[model samples]
Target: MLANFHQEQSTKSTLVYLTLSIDVARELTHVHLERFLAPLQCLRRLELVIARDAKRQFLDAGQWENFITEYLPRLITFEFKFSSEWRIGQYKLDQFRSPFWLDKRWFIAYDSSRSCLFTVPYFVPTSIKHSFVPVSTNLTTLPIEQHMVFYDRVTELRLQEHLRSLPYRYNHVKTLIIDTSCTYQNIIDLSKVQSLTVDISTLSLSSLMTAIKRSMPCVNYLSLNGSYWELSYMSFTGISLEQVRVLCLSRYANYQGDNTDKWSRLFPHVERLIVSIVSKSQIPLLIDQFKNIVSGFFYIDPPYIEPHNNDPLYVDPSYIDQIHIDAYNQIQVTHEWLMEHVNRFRQSNMDNFTYQINEGDRLSLSLWIGEDDKTAQVVMNSYFKKNIVDSMRTVRSKTENLSSNTTTVITDTSTTTTSATVTTSTVTTSTSSSTSTISTITTTTTTATSTTASTTTSITTTTATTVTTTTTTSTTTTAPYCTTRVTFDDIPGQSSTSGVVPNGYKNLNWTNVLYLNSSTMPTSGYQTAVNSPPFVGYNPGGTIVQITTANGTKFAFNSVIVSSAWRDNLVWSIYGYRSGTNLVYAPFTMSVINQTKISCNACSNWDTIYFTSSGGTPRSGLTGNGTEFAFDDLCISFGY
Candidate 1:
């Protein structure tokens, strides 16, 4: 009975305290072990029983000493067996036995072969000092089958004895693998684990989603079985949006029903996804269905769609001869259909787009005004075949109709007499008549007479004037000219001495500009060049110049000047090139005002500086034109 009791406890919990030999003692001891222990202490429940013959239970002196050394002093239980002929002697009793004492623990022994029993109770007077056995710190990873019972007992013991004893909580577990039988609650409790793989058949959808929401906050790699979507909708109710990074889905068949919407909600933030399916066609549709949920989805399939005829043509009906062709074909069709739907959905969102097939099996598309160029390019680039019309191209014909109806208008109006030539819908009309020709014009419904001869009579005095007026109107309408306004501001430092010149004055001169010595110049005071200079001073290091107003409030130039020589450099010095074409220079003139210093100042702010002729002799080895600098500006507007 005790053996049966031990076996039952072990099978249920698998936590063993100690073994006993006698059946009666085992029974008595197992019943009282839990009751006598401290309220918070974990009772070591027995799991196995061994009934050996008395002769086989012989113990040497050294063995006895070792046992006494380890088990004495503590009020622990022990069972011993004796031979059938042996009798309890005084020496043996004195050396090995102790009477039942409350302060010390009790020991029970049983001999199954002889049916003899012995019990040694705790005796404080006979106790010897002994070292306490240290508990192990290492934890064994339990298999999925045994985790439930193991974790329960471990947790119970931890809660009772080790909860407050440890410095930190026991949440360091990193990897968890759940098989098909684990319950939803079992997964939820393992939220601290960082990497998890779940067998899809184990949990309902609702439970799975809940687990994901709970566990995904820390998990980096998540692998799901193909049928994961089969779980209930409620299971994914509180899924976390940002936690998942890499997701792997395997052995997935075609979706059973209208599960598109549910999938979108479940994996909204999945960045990298890997899926294995029966058919390649279903891949696109599945991708489209969840495209918004994941950043990238990789579809892996067996090499079923092989090139046929060496012409880059894929084999049709890839799974026709396969064992599960029907299932594969259905999946393939669904995939292809899903992709088509996605393309349609995308195209429906575009406008004024046209698609055309190009050579080399390429597709070319154009987007008219107001259409998104980038989106069109993406759709065009993503097309696999030239003949396939992308979503953006479906409405191309609609754009054609609106574009065809457009008409260009040309209107002609004149002063002598208002003659209007209207061109609309591809037709041009010119109607001209003048009242001046008929000064005393009169009209009768049936007859008309003129005062002059028949040839000239048609042209009455007023008619003559009208004819002239009509001719003048026709000449004016044939050629029309109009003017638009143009304005120019005086470039800085180019103003006249008086600051105001007469309106009709054609020649403008600018003088008296001061050159300042400074490394950095303000950008606001000067009218800088609109672009980079035409001549870069060095192959690598280019010169940049800036002009600052007198008050240093404004500046403009091809680029910001950082060198001190910027103020002293000749305005016509070709510092750089603009657009690899036009020559650019500083608009200043350098003159030696004193023996030790020189002044470089803008010749004219109203116009760019140009040197027709430098009066000084040419520098050594330099000849011709004496560095004649010429730029287009207003101050140099007059020339001989």
Candidate 2:
């Protein structure tokens, strides 16, 4: 494609950006890549995903430096990744340390155990699976103190072997998959992991469960992959995982027969289930088992059918026929069979149930059960209230259709007299003759009225008086001032001393912020500019910090206390978002010695808020753009 483009297009040399992903099965090298990119001398940025075996010649930093200098003189950014079947040694590390590579701040790291080499951060994959056993880095241009940058992009980590102490820490991994024991909790931030999959082969389930409850309190989606018989080896006498709302079981992990009760006790609050079942009868059984289950996905496997043993009279017409069981074994499951089972469950449970079935190669049922009785009642009540208001509006609209030529009046001198709206529905009246007072209450109407009253007494003479009262009800609701400040202290089931702010802390979504103890890093501004500390929130250099409502609802942004974490006079560019639109934007400057108050008195109804920092003078011993800042006591308001 590149050669063809060069041959046909005169603007090939004007290319400014390029991305190439080489297939793993293809034998590609630097020579082939050079032939494609060498003509694009004006390219400013290039990304390469190389999946070939790591040859020393291709991995040489000096070769790449020479190639870039000669062929791509305008290239400002270069990112690449190379993986091999065998380890690459450290012989080429010196070449990457030369002034040619160091001048551009392009660093590299190689994992010998995994036989992978990549540019630091830019080419780093976000997901990594590693054996917990110790490994070594055979080559790198990064200093020993800066090795953590190699794993900075990792968000999902898998541990496949036994645990051991490591030199680096992973505080950002939010989805963890483990096959060994849970002893490596200290290596990564447990509170950050919202989804976890456990398939321990030799670890004690009870101990692992205890660790999960004690350390990983934020995990809401859990997958247990062992078979029920294997999982039953450990007693779940006192364990209850109420935090897990979505649960998944591997195809081998069947919760049937005697293990149903045991499994129910373990995940008592599970609202959704994804599991495999051998028969359709198990679907209703599972629904009855987990009374709180609001939805589920059941992969129903066909029953084993014996080959060449078919009797013409024994063929069942309910689900399958003899023709479906030909030598090729193409099976068909009837919709009537599934509906029969579903109706049976509904008849017994008396719940509002819905289902959608896919009759493809893999038969699966997606069920959405009604909410529990209490929740259903609330929903039904809201629906009825809405309909009632709509009906009243319709009546008012119809009443206004009366013609101006039409009039209705009823008068009985012996008793009382009443008047109807002649041309409009805005006014109504009633009067009594025998000294009875007339009261008219006006509510939520567009017109204004005044009351008049008079009385006359004579022989057999009566007087009628009318009184009108006006009542105004306001529908505007004012949200209460935020009583709860995100102090980064006293977080439940987390270390208050130091940690990263989990996504759902205090009902707000946090991004790129760290929880720091005020006393631990006094040299840093995260501690120096504290409000209600011992704890505060900080961001790494050159990163934006974002705070948003977890449920995506608009809330009021009251104020926040902020300070420069690594510099003085840091400029913060603040933006507030409603849905995807920018609603508010402002800029503020901060100092290192004292905390600055950013008050958002006019900022309201924002679903997300984020800030970026730049152009700060670095403090002593600090370096770089000084785009880091610390914050505490964030105040927000919501209606409910």
Candidate 3:
């Protein structure tokens, strides 16, 4: 049966536990026992409850020892239950005699109800010493139940030795909490912790403060609970309040009345101050005391008072302009109050103004008249269309055409109709001595003829005078000439050249001769000089002078050469003007290349000059009113 059971169990993958009857166990011999235990090989954790009757004969001390030594070694956890009649205590003692029984690989829990406490050996290996040593430097979150007994004793000499030997070290510890009682030694050890929370009695305040100063020199958040505030003034006298950036002083009533001044000094670095007030009148006192340091003050009012009170006796939030007070849900009034304070500070022209408002209130902005008010209004209207009004309407002018009578006069040999379309003040006359046709097209027409010779004359004369006269009367449309403004940088000069000359100008030859010199150039105001021998008048815009070599090669001056001794000292200038009655001269500087040549191809109606200095000062030869001269050997292109 045991062999069959083993075969069935081996065939199944599922873990199965069977509690066999004592009668069935007695029927199994040693050979059957091996088969019965064969199915137990696959068990993860096996619990064997030995029946009292089965142990009487089949399972003796020797048999149980043999099974345990050979079969139970592969199980992860083994629990053995002995019956009351089984004399197995002596055998168990012999099993534990082996050194492996004392190893910490397995956790052994015996039935203490049946066994004597003195006789049962509880094994604890020396390797458990690792539990007392520090493994990590960060102590933010630790299992309190596991380390609760060591909190007070953590600073003992032996534990400190173990901590010092830890491989990991911490320079700054954050968010350290000590729930159990702490000794002075423990506080000293925690002096390096930056943020700390502790539940300690009043007696531990000194140690806590000392640890705070040493461990967390710049603690931003400090939450202290328990009866630590009950300490007398003398006991808390040495505490440093400057390092506390945030202090949550819960249960403030427990602090003696005498300690209010001390508590007030603790928040020197606090910018956002949050405090609960028991009475409404205490709010004013709190504000008055810390107004200098606090920029944003939030007060949580007690629920007893009716927040909305129209009575004049009630506290008016307007009185405290800088601070935003919660008086029901009216945010507009608070916004206006904030703006009033901002305007007042702006008016004072202070370097640093404290802007204090409610913690969650959005700042209010205002608009007033300024230089940019018109621009601001346009922008505001674009964003908020309904708030703005258009105040001005556009106006335009109407155009009118006046009709007038016009008469035109034409004196010619041919008879033709004259039209009056001339709209200028000047009269134009076209005289034709020979047979010619004269015609005028305009709005009005008139015709008249005059004969100078008789028709009977037989002389063969090719000249015949035909006088045809027509009058054109019209209104003048020309306006008076206005003098044009001139500037210094508008001087006309020359143009740049590419190496590849054009086809018609490719055969031209040019020289770097002195085209302009300080001697002949204008110094100041406009003047004209006559063209002399060896010097020709070359129109920069029209015809160019061409020079040909003895070898029949045609050459043109590509640039002009100017010589000025005072070139660097003098600011040379050039200009051009319309040569008529209302002359308008625009003076400009001519850019001189190689201290001489000006690209003549680029110049347009330009006259050059050399100034002794800028701002109307003229140079001599270099410094005079003005002078002009004709250019010599100037080049022009004509050949192939």
Candidate 4:
């Protein structure tokens, strides 16, 4: 019987490893089968496993037939054991007297105490052959945990064979859910997968990018859920963005750093960008930074009032619904501004510019790559509408419809007869329950009353107070005034190897912003202040500040002032619209104010100007003996 069982098990697998001796198998009989399998609910759930045998220790065909045809029952699968090895003669004792395997060999013991699967050994298969039965649960994205029905899916693993076997777990998985424990190797081979969600709260951006480079060749969509501040900076060296196109980045409220550069660096070619904007105030800054994006999805979070610098306290969430509505309205205004000024971005020259918007998250004002502005507004406002009108309407109607309504409920116990009453009037809270009526029960028994000798009564009353408030919102627009500041940070990236800015006055410190010429560039990149240095600015050596808008529109302004010295024979000329028409000022007559502020008197309502030495001609008002012509900060005053 022992040889027959071993032979049958051997036929079930390519390799058979035996832990039991021949004597033990021989001692097992039909009478002992139940005792050995007493913990199993049914024989079908038993795994028909055979140990791996690479050392040529398998049984013959004749024994294989005898053992299978006689003792074995119907089984679902063959569980190939992860045993050490099979030696030809390791069992010194008689084969029939071998010890039984210690793990889940023939039975799965149930634990009625906890109503769940008990802890099993690592070597033991927690799930038997019957565990892989196909059911009609129809679940798409399964979240795996350690206990309950949770099962480890595509996560950290040691061997390559385990990775190859993942297809058996799920027939076709398009999306994967991996937690912090997942490594680059674990998900590097999911070839068919198309979308990936990374929780950067735990994993580093470098590790995630490495995995993406190694594995996600076909994946084009990605969503990152974490703080943008965590991504202080990113340099894309090995990351492949040839296929990736869409990204939904949800930076939490606490994130401070700008994610524009990070996103531009890591996924340079991403076409559709979605971001979680905590408040409407960040809209202008976010818009000013990121450019050339095809679509935008701005998910507006609940409004958080900007607390003062030193104030520390927690605020409850019981504020009125109007507060929430105002936040949404602010976002609406920002969205409108974006749509109106969207053409401003196209000024840099685009092919066939058009517009469309859509909802991003269910409540988020996301911009999908599609059309129809009406649909976008509907989707964006859906959440606020539901919460404000439809969802709360039922509760409000219950309280406001009736001036006063009363009902009661009654319960009775044989041991005691008690009476209870409850009354509700005019004022009411926004709370709700199913109970509407209350009744009192009195059992009139002289003998019962005599034995108890007690009287019981209860009374309850609810009073509701209603407070009404009205809020009005107003907005005002004012024209911009004149102000001058210097920081050489603009665009058109370059230098002539001499570290000289265009036209030779400043140096490009890797930033386009204006940085005043100091003869040597500072590493900090922001050392330009008009308040500093021999009156701060530039003679441009020969180059001039030729102002023009990117859209070919006239750069109209009321007054033009140049930071130049007011000295004899040191005069700067100006050219532009004079009194709403294009004109140029002769170098000699230009007004130099206060020896520090040079005024372009003739170039009023100017559209353009070139601050130069007026063809080197000596010209000025009453001034000093020294001749010095230098220009620094340029201020343009515009008003309606």
Candidate 5:
């Protein structure tokens, strides 16, 4: 089986893949691993898990780095597993630093061991070069003199030492994470650490307050995942937090209800807050409390890991827990509530907000805060690089119709109302116009429709048919219309996000456009020169040449989603390129009906237009918070 696996991987040698193993197959040799990896040049992510008793002493980190660099030059994400088995004679980080590269910003040393002071080839944040971590379990803390500039670039820090561990003085941590095991002295003495996470499970509320007052007096950002809201309110009532800016509270489990406004009162000076509000009734109370708050990420459901298998049918659909059913149903009501409440938030000091709504366990809707261009661009790049929709073909939708054949005798039942939409059918068909029909054999006048457009019924005489049917019924019914579209399954360039985005046409007019490389966009030929400065991204961001002002639309490319600040409304926008040097812009005018006079005035010969709104409140459609608009997608339309 191992041999066959390597063979299969070798067959697809040109592809990139990930191998996630808790323990690699013992029988697989160096040759087998090489066979599987040699063919993969575009290995974007690679993760490996090695158990302690495993025969890993023979593995040289330097050798592995050489092998990866020689074969996979495109490896951007390498998640090396760091287990708790940090004894001497293990595969230390020193063995890898000789020729390999490790950037702190690109590395994340997760929970438990994040603060372990690895000595040899130390991954300390010194000189802005090594900004994150270095790993070696064989050693302990080095003398302070040996680590003079170690914590320079360390902007964020997490400390999870046991109560028995000796106190390690940190003079420069800006963000800090400490669990209940740490001594109160350590928490209270950390004057430099600003943002802090206080685990309610470990530390008592009173002790936490004492730590805040004595040590972390200047702490600004506060985040808590554990719950002890009642005690927290009592402990924080008189504590002064005049310098705090952001407050975040997340409920994991056993989250009992609270008065909710206690935090707002305790941290009256907080400018920004992120929370998972358990009760809708508390919203008005919060708005009433902090009137000048900046921004936040809000949701009702506590953060929990989804099960491995996401498909409902795999676990038997009938056995679905009611809790999940409730969560699914709560989304629509909660989302609508948040949207309506956004305008209310605007009345306060909030310039923009993001609403996050999770679409199942997969995708979500988040928009960037358009408060300022720089911050908005940061948020935009974060989300936009992810896949989004262009062609409607990728959309998942459901359709239902009220047919003429579904007619019944008008017994005239009193009245009916429903708070939710109930779906009894899943038949999907596109409709250009809404239509309804009624037909009956009883004493009722009815209009019936077959698959054909129109039909006439004979009642004694054809002329009498119309009159008799018209006289029999006095009531009429209309069917409801709705369109459901699913997005974020695909981002144009990345293959991982672009699922189900087939190139074929959903209709004759629309093509599911996709571009993985720059060569595929603008057809590789018509683009001549870039004239306008890029609006949202780094200079000439990627493979696609941006179509900006007066770069005559020769190949005729169209629209890309850009931040308002990135967009230049002066002359032209970056969407396409000029084809012929004669660069004759086929100027044309488009009139949106009812907004103005439906008239077209020919201007320049330009065929493409790029446009966007500059300022507005954006909701994070993903969580029903404000928008995480930073990660939106843009596309160029050939219009062919």
Candidate 6:
């Protein structure tokens, strides 16, 4: 069964996390477990929940220890809950209390009544379904005794109709799924809850709103799963969930005509929406209603097709010759419909904004409302590259035309587009130089284009005209202003965890930032931000960092290469100061893995500089907004 369940023949995938919840009905053996885990050599974390098993061999810690040591050496975190039918004293628990687990602080707990042995803290489920009885006994090999708190790992909790009174505290629960009444305020900490899923079939919307207002103040992601007809009749006039930014509606709910206004009034600050619509026409109404929506996932119903009418009992003549709509055709129609509707709305309402639509399991539309200077810079570079490619293609076509003896008048002009400007003037030049000497021209003459003859003529006249030209002949040399470039590679302890940039080392006082070797600690941010061999400087926290001369000497801040540490579109701001006065300020946005050059040429003779980061979207497959940034190749000058 395990072999058939995972049919992937290749084991070359870098699978990092694996979770197995198996029942002992199939009788899992040690060989089966080894074969199942053999392909996952790169697994970093593993969680298992085995139920109703009398297999004493599965609970042997020494076997697990040896298996992990030999086969899964890359495994850093392991959690499991093995429930057996064995009696309280049937198996010895001392095998679990070993140096291998104790040194790593991986504690375990046993519930003799339930016959469950599980890892402490790590094995605690995130989402629990009602009446959770806390574990009583914890066994460990450590000398120092410590209190074990299990609810720290619980992020989502589902409650029953009747809540039980328990003397327990939960501070980390972020999601609360409730169906009916609850006395949870006394035991559970709803202050930290950000998501609330209410089964309104059993509970009243008004009562839920009252509870949200009283308890769940931080709730921003709300999911209402219940009957659509019942919810429509209920009035939500006075209730306004302004804090909700992400709203997920029940798939069973109908969102046809007037329902748009109902949901719009309820969630006014909704930026991310997950919804279900009955027809494609409702998409425009949704976009019109939710003006604040930046991105959305829409579950659209596929078009229904009529079956072939070959039976004698066919009821309606209208269904006799109906066109069949296949999945491919339906998807194409959907794509075209989205482009037509969404682009029309964007042109009228959001002219300056850009949006992208994709078709998959769900129709996703993400809009870029307002971008920072850094994001703009990245977009501009791509746009420039595209234009260059297009211009080359155009030039190639023109060259082909010239070779074919066709009269092609190509005129380059100075004009400005939306974000870029182009200026062109045709020029003709001749260069002649020797090995020992070189010639320079200060001024050059211009000429007009000669008139062309008839089209039948085989002569292909190609003229390069100069509108304005200037040349100079002089010899002057100057010393380089930027004599030193700090690359962070010369710092001692290159492979250490972290090292601070000393005051006198680079004649600068670095504050609130540290340099770390990416090779030693290959974290997500450091791996992408490292430009040099091993070292890169960064401030993990979004604090106001500073760089100042130790002896109060002034320097010119030229430029530096910077990258986002853990996010995309990260805005990094740098302010140059001289004698407590702000001289120059520059702010730019950056994406992870892309090192951007930020020029601070205007900043000169500054005694100090302040750096701060703010506002960035999380990188792909990562959680939370990262306001941290990494920087290297700082070019500064003391010549000022």
> How well does each candidate superpose onto the true structure, as a TM-score?
0.25, 0.50, 0.25, 0.30, 0.34, 0.40
Give me the displacement of residue 158 in model 2, in angstroms. Answer: 1.8
In model 1, the Cα lDDT at residue 347 comes to 53
What would the TM-score be for candidate 6 when compared with the true structure? Answer: 0.40
Highest-TM-score candidate: 2
Once fitted onto the true fold, the runs of candidate 5 whose alpha carbons sit more than 4 angstroms away are 1-122, 125-161, 164-168, 184-189, 232-237, 252-258, 302-640
Off by over 4 Å in 3: 1-173, 178-181, 199-207, 214-218, 226-238, 253-260, 280-640
Error of 6 at 209 (Å): 2.2
State the C-alpha lDDT per candidate. Answer: 0.28, 0.57, 0.30, 0.33, 0.34, 0.54
Best-matching candidate per lDDT? 2
Per-residue CA lDDT of candidate 4, range 1-640, in tens?
A: 4324434444433221112222122334433433333322222213222333212222222332244335433321112221213222213212312222111121111122221111111122222212221111121111111111112122211211223222123212345444443443432345544566665466677767677777666556676765432554534565646556666666533454445555566676665556665544444444444443445555544454232223122122222223323423422443345455444333532223233333332334433223322232213533432232222112101111100121222211111323333233223331322111122111121221121111122222222234454432323233343333332333246331112233322211111112243333221111121223323333322223344332233333323223223232233444353333335432322212212233221122344444433221222322111122333344444321
Candidate 1 deviant stretches above 4 angstroms: 1-170, 183-191, 226-229, 232-241, 292-640
**Could you give candidate 3's per-residue lDDT for residues 361-435 as a string of tens digits?**
322211221222222110111211112111110112121111122221222212232322223453443332221
Off by over 4 Å in 6: 1-55, 58-107, 111-116, 126-129, 136-148, 179-183, 229-235, 255-257, 301-328, 331-640
Query: By the TM-score metric, which is better: model 4 or model 6?
Result: 6
Worst 10 residues of 3 by lDDT: 448-457
Tens-place lDDT per residue, model 6, 354-404, is: 333233322222233332221200011112222322222211010111122
- Give the winner by lDDT: 3 or 4: 4
**67-175: candidate 5 lDDT, tens digit per residue:** 8779887764454443333333323534543425322112222222432212111133322211223222223222222222233324455655544422233344556
Error of 3 at 477 (Å): 99
lDDT of 1 by residue, 237-320 (tens): 566545555555653433344454566566665544555444344444554555442223323234422223332212234343
Q: Per model, how many backbone clashes are there?
A: 48, 0, 29, 37, 52, 3
lDDT of 2 by residue, 433-510 (tens): 222111111111111111111111111122223343563222322335565578888676667455657878888877
Model 2 TM-score, 2 decimals: 0.50
Judge candidate 6 at residue 315 and give its lDDT. 21
lDDT of 6: 0.54
